[model samples]
Target: MRFMFKTDYEDDIKLFPHSGYLWSYGSLLLVLMIAPFVLSSYLMSQLVFVCIYATVGVGLMILTGFTGQASLGHAAFLAIGAYTTAYLQQFGVPFIVYFLAAGVLTGIIGAMVGFPALRLQGIYLVIATISFAFIVEEILARWESVTHGNEGMRVKTIQILGTAVPRDSPAFYYLCLGVLILTIIGSLNLLRSPTGRAFVAIRDSETAARSMGINVSLYKVKSFAISAAIAGFAGCLFAHKLSFISPEMFTLQLSIEFIIVIIIGGAFSLHGAVLGAIFVVMVDPFLTFLKDDIPGVIGGLAATLGAGAQKASHIQDSVAAFASANGLKGAIYGIIIILFVLFEPLGLYGRWLKIKLFFQLFPLYKRATFKRQKIYVKSERNR
Candidate 1:
């Protein structure tokens, strides 16, 4: 195994600690830069969505992962961004301006929502965030003059320097890729700063952070603003990608999916957010494939059991019906959360670390390498 020896204080904040990260990520970026030219149209689209979701995931990771703030109303911020894009696009403003306008507006709203909720913790904080989402959803629906209510607003193609950027074109893909890169860079820098350390300290224990002179409430609000701003950035691209915006698109379900993205990707790690976004962006399509194949398998099994053609058809239809329910997908998500919490709380990125460590240690590897450390509090008596 390669050992990294720290020589100076600057090494602690180096973006790439060693040559390994630099090379690996450099190669990855090279591959992605060339991907649009070689990949199929469908694959290109999937990659675009992955970038968008990953951007949102990183923002959430900053709050929920690094900062230990739990929020379930990111969908509201997303809606704000999308609708802002939809409304602003009509005036033919520069893409950068409206894109930023969305994030700023949403961030301000998030700060407002987060301010009062600072006194709450755990599930109560979650409820406060979700409640904010509910209010946003209601506003989007009732404000028909602006959002067009259930009718949904149409989004225009993105334009840059007088050129239209089609969603499927390489330029569009590169745009999304560039945004993702910038988002990751900004988030990394934030995590390296004193504010970032404050976030981690708050996450570890708000009480301790307060004792250390960290303004916990102010920082928490800042965290929400930053997280919501990131989600808003994702919304701008998501709006253009779909070519439409509707309140329904930014429901509680979508917020839940964001949570699922970070959880399955791995909490407290930026890599987990990216990995989770990839998994989430691909899940519906995977289910679609399964939906087409499962009924046939059910029918074949019934036939092999000597069931009549009518009986086989009945069994197949029943299976198809069950699979068709949207609730089934939600239930599947619930089960996935349960399983991940119980069996792999660290998530997909955590599993990758374990595998890497196993290969590195080989004969000397033990399960305890990844075991959770016990938390202890100190007092006059304990000390």
Candidate 2:
């Protein structure tokens, strides 16, 4: 159990609420700084992926979680960033210039999309975003001169201060970590500002927020711009990491994966983005391993069950065919989304909060402490 005693108004809104947070976060920073020295190269690469995805997840959380405006087309922003960066690099643009340009361009585009989308709500907004994603994907595929169409385009190595940073080097990993830290700090600061409060107010009740004199439309568009900018920044890092990108890489499925990150991590919390990114990136390798090994496992199990050689061979072939199907991964993702929505809507962060509360309360903790209430509303009855 940790206790924080507030001394003044400043304490109430401090980024780190307690000494415990300072020490914990400081330790985490230390660990991240030294991680590359101890972790394998492959693991370090995955960490880069986590940081990039976490950036996108945090952006999406700002829109859907804080602003109550959901976007299913963030992958389009990411694609814009990657393609823009790649194109500019070919023209001998500096890394920083193109990176910032990519983000700015995406922000402008996002604002344009959000402006027209202000009248949309609920499922209509979702459908519109989905349509936007498809449109972007088609443009990327057909714009052969700029994007190279389906042939894809290679990204230049990240260069900083006259040094080309190798993708697998510790310097690249540290670069990613540095950018991630800056993003987190920016997000935390933004959330502490009055604008953040307005966003939350809008989220809770748009009519109430408008009545309170908040410019709901402007704020919604601002939220989209900021979110898209962050995603574009992440996409810049992503292109450099992969060294190549295609229209297929930024599909609707990629956007859905970003949504899953926040949904499973805890939509309402910034830390949830990092936790979700780690979970998704870490689990991905295991899924790949399973895809490679499941057929062998099935064959061995069939042999143990005293099946004939031909039968065992047929079973292994069938299992391999199933394992290799691309849709299998999609099915797994869908099932996971369904399970999390049904059983843990608040997600892993919410679960962690519960565990911490239980420990704090100890013997005073009751099973009903956070039980869900089955409230029957008169409005529902009337409907």
Candidate 3:
């Protein structure tokens, strides 16, 4: 029986040549490197934008995603990082040191913010965090000397480790990519360790976890601090990348966008965060192209809007306005959360697992059968 089972497993392994782990890592690396070379300037900008979002998404994954703490004011943390970097840079601090300082400072702030978690849970915690974010923004706006108010602060080319690097240079891309890779690795390692598992256990049930000897409060506060630190690191990277910082950029809307990313990508899973970033980043351009190029080819069908066609030519513009104005991303994100809550709470990663399982177990697999149920159960229990 052992020999038969071994032979069957070998056959299965041969059928699936690439391990999921290898495929995920290799694919991500290849895309990150090749994207700069293959993509146009317009696209490179979008890709850079995606990396920025991914950086924050990773942070959120650690907090709301992994530790089950919800924050709608995450952009506030990013604001803290961005402004801290800008202010420090103005005083002629070394860029790397300033960025590190931003992370540490924000980590401290995050811990303080996590104090509310002692009493609040569920949506109440969300409200507390969101309120904290707004309060911070108000301080930044009113404290003109520091945040520079609505005019914001400008950063020159960052001098890191004794080398000056321009924001838009290819070197910047490499730098952001390196930071992203390291952060992801750090997060993954943390998730696999005892402390990380303790966070997950606490997220699942603070009462139960505490009963089992886990320090629930410690983990909760630590998770917030760690998450905020990551957000701050990403914010500093954004400051350098854009070289222009503004209070307007870190509004509640931006916080909603961060949430959208994890919701669309998959909360509690690193891959989901990455994928969510990609989806949000790419969707605009994809639709823009459709609005412009598609209308040229397919606009003949909607010829009645001929005179008005030029004004409404780009579906992307109108859709984007609607999305931004009515919080389309937020609405979509909420719907996604609802759907996940109703049927597929694991998000895109869960859906991808289902697809992979179907393919791997094909031929013998029946239609509409849930092959990835165990993964969902485990992941949800961890959350």
Which prediction has the highest TM-score against the true structure?
1
Per-residue C-alpha lDDT of model 2 across residues 165-213, encoded as one tens digit per residue: 9889999888888888898899888988989989998887776787799
The per-residue C-alpha lDDT of model 3 at residue 113 equals 93
lDDT per residue (tens digit) for residues 1-383 in model 3: 01223455445434223466578778878877887788777777777778888988999999988899999988999989988898887778887789899999999999999987778888898889889988998888899978878888887888877887777667788888888888888987788778888988877767668779998888899999999999999989888777888877788888887887898787868988888898888867755564456545544434455646655556435544543454444565566668776776667887897777777777666655743443333334655
Each candidate: RMSD: 2.2, 2.5, 5.9
TM-score versus the correct structure, for each prediction: 0.95, 0.93, 0.82
- In model 1, pairs of residues that clash are 265-272
Sequence-dependent TM-score of model 3: 0.82
Candidates ranked by TM-score: 1, 2, 3
When 2 and 3 are scored with TM-score, the better candidate is 2
Clashes of 1: 1
**lDDT of candidate model 2 versus the reference:** 0.90
For 252-329, candidate 1 gives per-residue lDDT tens digits of 999999999999999978899899999998988878876888999989999999998999999999988888876878
